[model samples]
Target: MKKLVVMGGGIGGVASAYELKQAVGSDHEIILVSDNPWFEFTPSNPWVAVNWRKPDAIRVDLDEAMSRRGIRFIHDPVVRVRPADDQLDLSSGTVLDYDMLVIATGPRLAFDEIEGLGPEGFTSSVCKTDHAAATAQVVEKLCEAPGPVVIGAAQGASCYGPAYEYAFILETELRRRKVRDRVPMTFVTPEPYIGHFGLDGVGDTKGLMESELRERHIKWLTNHRIDRVESGVMHVTGVKPDGSDAESSTLEFAHSMILPAFTGIDAVMGIDGLSNPRGFIPVDEFQRNPTYANVYAVGVCVAIPPVGKTPLPVGVPKTGFMIESMVTAAVGNIALALAGEEPRHRATWNALCLADFGDRGVAFLAVPQIPPRNTNWSSSGKWVHLAKVAIEKYYLHKVRKGTTEPFYEKFGMKLMGAGKLRGQA
Candidate 1:
């Protein structure tokens, strides 16, 4: 049997493993390795931090889930990857070999790059479950004090959705508690504009987000680079239109949350020919690593360049649906190769974002993910909130049930009024 090893047990990794099992059936041996056995539903993390959702409601037992689908699970962190030898050194002093390797390891937070940042100091993050819990406690204390709040993403940060979500959620929470007047909220981001969102303003997102921020009385600072975060104060230097230093400003806050930039995971960073200088793996249009034919990557770990240049940082946004599409394509190709059949690539990814706005929500759709034409659309409504809730519940159920079917694929097709995917023979 062909042996397949998948690293990381997050959403991307788990989804890939499940899809691999479905594609190859019981013919191949699949092993998933991760430091943690439990998979956290990352998208719901914002809610978890604010007491809207519980921790247990978003976590799942990966071992049980994968075992039921005939995939082996190892709760161990990968220390090093000897890609040339097809072996991996685990932190527990064990080495494992694989015929094929799938790198779904997510991005690593680079908090140390900034001065006086991270958990030890003034700001907090909602990127992880632990961070969220910690931030929740801090937020509770801040609620009692009722002071200034600052929220936004740091330099080179690609995942801007969470930052925006946290900002709006906090705004909504303050309104709910009737403390909106007591707290002065500010949104600071490295994005050149209000809603660049790393993908270069998707379908009026720029206008819509700016309008919403203004309506909510949320002050924003754009094209700003944070030099250091001190006690209750953030020092920022805004970039001029010509990309030069414009002016320096210092903003004080009682509580702050800033999303740090992400780099490639440590293991994959040291591998030659497998990753870029930025440590992101380079994959073909089909999501297969060019240098290592048997290696595939998905999610934020894959190196995709920015859509356009902005005064501030701009990056490609990898939504959940996009990640799912990549995983599906990779799994199908690998399964075909294992079955001694010619591999074919036939999957396209699009962006679907549902931004929650305190009492309501806004939705955006970008067919074919890339810009410069195609069907691009966006809308705002309360139903967007309902749809988000439904998606969360559906995903949680699937994770608990250990199913491999691509829910996003079905949902995307339904939205586009397209036909079903062609099943493998």
Candidate 2:
């Protein structure tokens, strides 16, 4: 029997595992290895950061969930990956052999790249459930003693939606507590424009986002990079389109949360033909590694180029829907490989995002996450916030049940009609 191993326990990893099992059935052995024991609904992290959702409420015990599906679960961290030998060494001195390896081990937050960044330093983060829970305490403290607030993504960061979500959500919470008037909020980012989002303003997102910021009385700095974050102060540099320095300034804040750039995890880093310079796995359209055909990757661990160039680096985001497509494509390719057939399936890489702002939210759909898409749409309303909440609960329930069905394809597509556009090309 063929042995397949999927790494990581995030959305992509769990989804891949469930899908792989369904595709291969009981004929092949399927194993899921994760550093953590719980599957976190990451999109709800902004809510967690503001105490709207508890950490336990958004997390699922992966050990129990995977057990019901007849899959072996390893809760140990992977220490190293030896692609040449098709082997993985775990931190607990255990080794695993696999005929096929699916990498869904999401990015390693690169907070260390910047001085005084991250929870260990001067700022807070909402990247993980624990991080969000801890940040909620900080948010409570901010409400108690209101002051300036800084919320944005660092240079080279790809995930801008959470940064925007946190900014607006926190603003909403502060306003609810009647402390917003005392807190002057500023959004700083590496995007060339207000809503570049690394994919370059989807469907007038620039206008909508800028308008939202203005309406909320929040200031912004685009094409800006944080040089260093000192306690209660942020050193920032502005960059011109020509890559020249535009301005250098320092802003003081009582609280801050900066989303750091992401890189591949340590286990897969520096593998000669498996990973790129940034430690991200380089995969073809079918989500199979070019050098190692037996290797496939999905989620934030996969390498995708930026949509275009900007003054500051802005990596493309692998949204939840896009990652779902990747997982489906990778699992299909693996099934074909088991049958001794060549890889053929390809992921559409389309993006559909719901950026919640507490009482209201923004939703966007890009036919193909890259620019020049057949369909590019974005809208904002209270419905979006409600939709995000519903999706979070539905997704968590789906994960617990080990359902391999594609949630976004089945629900989001019919809701937005973007799936019809995918049939065009």
Candidate 3:
């Protein structure tokens, strides 16, 4: 039997593993390697940072879940990847060889890109479950002693949805505690505008997000690059449209959560053409690495260029929906390769997001994640918040049950009507 290995345990990795197993069944051996033993629902991380959801509520024990599907689970960190040899070296002195390797290891948080950033430094983060749990305690302390709050993404940071969600979620929480009036909030981002989101304002996100921030009285500084952070203060340099520095300012805060930039994991970095300069895996349309045919990648670790130019660097976001599309296409192509056939599947990189505030939220659907799309729509309401809550639970359930079905294709098609996706590349 051919042995196939999948790395990482995030949405992309887990989905790829399950789908691969279903495609080949017991005909081939499938193994999933992860640094951690549990699969944390990452989208729920913002809520965890505020104690809205406990850590346990969103994590699935990977070992138990994978065992039920007859997939071997390895809980060891990868030290290095020898793509040419089709081998992986683990931190525990174990070596693995595979006929096919799917690298779904998510991006490494580049907190060190800025001084005094991330959980180890001055600011808090909601990128990981552990980080979120720790940040939740900080949130409690902030509520007891209210002051200024600074929230936003740092320079080169791609993911902006959670930053926006955290800003509003915290605002809603503080209001519930009756301390919001005393806490002055400010949002600082590298995007040229409030909702650039790396896809250049998908579905009127610019107008909707700006309106939300204005109504909530959250002051903002767009096109701003964080220079550094000290205790209770952040130094920022404002950028002009010509990619030049304009003004310098310092923001004082009692609490702050800044999303840092992302890079590929150390194991896969600087491996010839396997990864980009920033270490993100470069994939063809079929999600297979161009230099290494057997190497497929998905999720945030995969590299895609920014949608447009801006004052500062902005990376494209691989939303959950887009990642699911990648996983589906990768699995299909792998199955074709196993059967000695040419690969033909290509994933549709659509973007779907449910950005939740505590009381309400916004939903965005872009038929194609990039601009010049066929369908671009966005709406906001309490229903959006409720839908996100339901999705979190459903996604966790899917993981636990080892379901291989793609979630986004059906959901997006129904949400936008079937006609939007018909006759597209």
Candidate 4:
């Protein structure tokens, strides 16, 4: 019997295991290893940061959930990934050998790339559940003594949705606390313009998000390169579209949350031809590592080039739906290989995002996520906020049950003219 080992228990990892177990039948052994014992619903992290959600409400026991589906689970962190020998070393001294491997370890928060940033530094973060909970505590403290606030993403930060979401969520929370007036809020980002979202301003997202920020009484600074963060102050260098110096200033703030650049996790970083300089796994269109055919990657762990060049670095986003498409393609190809067929699955790699801002939000769609695409559209409404919440709940439930491609989400996406990656050539 073939042994299929999936590393990382994030959305892509869990979903990949589910699809593998179902497709491979009971003949193959499958196991998922994750550093954390519980799976956190990442999409709700912004809400968690503002006390709108308790961490426990959006998390589930990874071991129990996977065991129910006849898949093994390990909570030990990966020590090293020896792709040459198909060996996986764990922190607990367990060495796992796999016939096939799926890598979904997710992004390594590159907090150290920026000095005095992240939770360990002077700012807060909504990247992880614990970080979000900590930010919530800080929010309460801010309520008692409101002051200047700053929220934004650093250079080369790919996942820009959460930054936007956190900004608006904080705004909502501050307003609800009746301390909005006291807290002068600012949104600073490395994008050339507001709402670039790492996709070169998808379908009027610039106008929609700019208007939202304006209507919410929030100020913004784009093409802003953060030099560093001192206590209660962020040094920023504003750049023009041509990469020339435009302005420089120091902004003081009582509270701040800046998303940092992301890189590959340590286990698989610098693996010869497997990864790029930033530690992100470089995979072919089928999500298969070009150097190692047995290895596959999905989600933030995979490398994606920037949408376009800007004065300040801006990486493209791999939205949830796009990640799902990746998971589908990777597993489907693995199934084909097990059936004595060549790997042949292509992911649509489309992006659908809902950036909730408490009471209302903005939504966008990018078919074939990369630029020069066929479809690009964006809009806003209160319904977006409601949809975001529902999606969070739905995804958490699906994780708990170990059911990938929930019928409702799958059918709903299809009904809305959304498509997942499937076998093509």
Q: Global CA lDDT of candidate 3, please?
A: 0.92
TM-score of 1: 0.95
Q: What is the lDDT of candidate 2?
A: 0.92
Worst 10 residues of 4 by lDDT: 416-425
Q: After superposition, how far is residue 56 of candidate 3 from its true place, in Å?
A: 0.3
TM-score to native of every candidate shown = 0.95, 0.98, 0.98, 0.96
Better of 1 and 4 by TM-score: 4
Name the candidate, 3 or 4, with the larger TM-score value.
Answer: 3
lDDT tens string, model 1, 337-386? 78777668745777777787656777776777778647566666677678
Backbone clash count for every predicted candidate, in the order shown:
0, 0, 0, 0
Q: Estimate, for each residue in 29-65, the C-alpha lDDT of model 2 and write its tens digit.
A: 9999999999999999989999999999999999999
Please provide, for model 3 over 1-425, each residue's C-alpha lDDT reduced to its tens digit, 9 standing for 90 to 100: 99999999999999999999999966999999999999999999999999999999999999999999999999999999999999999999999999999999998999999999999999999999999999999999999999999999998999999999999999999999999999999999999998888888877789999999999999999999999999999999999999999999999999999999999999999999899999999999999999999999999999999888888998888999999999999999999999999889999998999899989998888878898988777778897899899889889999999987778776776665644434432
Residue 317, candidate 4: Cα error in Å is 1.0
Lowest summed lDDT across 10 adjacent residues in model 3 is found at 416-425
What's the CA error at residue 79 for candidate 2, in Å? 1.1
